[model samples]
Target: MIHLTLIIVDFLTGLLAAGAWALASAGGAIAALVGSGFVGFSLFRKWRRRQ
Candidate 1:
């Protein structure tokens, strides 16, 4: 019985870690996208001003 309980605990811990990793990966991607968009907009404005 104790062995089964330990296995269950281990599985839960692994699942939580995987979920956290996925969340971090998605967050990083979103941040990169937003950062690139902001940079592009800034450059576009600067170019338009010279027109």
Candidate 2:
């Protein structure tokens, strides 16, 4: 019975770890996208100003 409990706990820990990793990855991707968008917009504005 103890062994079964340990197994279940391990499985749940692993699942939670995986979920956290996925969330971090998604957050990072979104951050990168927003950063790039801001950079692009700034560059576009500078280019238009020169013209």
Candidate 3:
């Protein structure tokens, strides 16, 4: 019984850790996308102004 409990606890902890890592990675990806979009828009505006 004790061994079973230990395995279950380990599995749950691993699952929680993986979920946290995935969330952090997704957040970073979204931030990068947003930053790139803003940069692209600014460049386009500057190009248009020169033209």
lDDT for each residue of candidate 1 in 1-51, tens digit (9 for 90 to 100)? 999999999999999999999999999999999999999999999999999
Q: Each candidate: what lDDT?
A: 1.00, 1.00, 1.00
Ranking according to TM-score, highest score first: 2, 1, 3
Candidate 3 global lDDT: 1.00
lDDT of 2 by residue, 1-51 (tens): 999999999999999999999999999999999999999999999999999
Compared with the true structure, the alpha-carbon lDDT of candidate 1 equals: 1.00
Clash-forming residue pairs, model 2 = none
Name the runs in model 3 displaced over 4 angstroms: none
User: Where does candidate 1 stray beyond 4 Å?
Assistant: none
lDDT of 3 by residue, 12-33 (tens): 9999999999999999999999
Candidate RMSDs in Å, in order, are 0.4, 0.4, 0.9
The TM-score obtained by model 1 is: 0.97
Error of 2 at 4 (Å): 0.4
For residue 14, give model 1's deviation from the true position in Å: 0.5
